[model samples]
Target: MRTEEIVAKALEKIGNDRYLLSNLVFSRVKQLCAGAKPLVDMDLKHNKLSDIAMKEIAEGKISIDRIDEKNL
Candidate 1:
């Protein structure tokens, strides 16, 4: 799907809160950059880490609660 569509879906997954979405995406991207395994199946070599993070959120593979738990 298109980037816009993926972003919209990811926003929906997080109750349409852009702030929360941004935070989640940022955290996930950081983890990805730090060598953390992606939660979703995708081409890591070709796709950007931020895009992969959003895809994980859009597909319900990542969520605010999960992030919170990890942080805690």
Candidate 2:
């Protein structure tokens, strides 16, 4: 599935259990986008991820933030 779609699906399951799982997924979204040809164009853009917070997504590192970025 596309990055956005994956993130959206994730948000669906993360109704009130916002924790490590969300961080991990958000990080994945950033990481995957970083590997994309045009990095800027591959962002997931869910919740409200900031540039710094976005690093987790790019590097696949664990983060404490609870927001995701979105271009929708």
Candidate 3:
């Protein structure tokens, strides 16, 4: 899927809350940068960390409750 489509799906998963989406993506990206494995399966070599993070959110692999539980 395209980046915009992924972002829209991610936003929908989060009730269209832009701020929360940003926070979630930022936190996930930070974790990715620190060696955290991606929750979604994708080509890590080709995709940017931020894109993977958003895809995780889009696929419902990552959510606000998970973030709070994991303190991510």
Instruction: Output the number of the TM-score-best candidate.
Output: 1
- Pairs clashing within candidate 1: none
Name the weakest run of 10 consecutive residues (lDDT summed) in model 2: 63-72
Summarize candidate 1's per-residue lDDT along 1-72 as a digit string, tens digits: 999999999999999999999999998888888888988888889899999999999999999888887672
lDDT of 3: 0.91
Instruction: Write down the worst ten-residue block by lDDT for model 1.
Output: 63-72
User: Number of clashes in every candidate structure?
Assistant: 0, 10, 0
For residues 1-72, what per-residue lDDT tens digits would candidate 3 score against the true structure?
Answer: 999999999999999999999999998888788888988887779999999999999999999888777676
TM-score of each: 0.90, 0.27, 0.89
Clashing pairs for predicted structure model 2, backbone only: 27-57, 30-57, 30-58, 31-57, 45-69, 45-70, 46-68, 46-69, 46-70, 47-68
Model 3: clashing residue pairs? none
lDDT digits (tens) for residues 1-72 of candidate 2: 455654444444544344744565556456455642223333445433433234333433333343343321
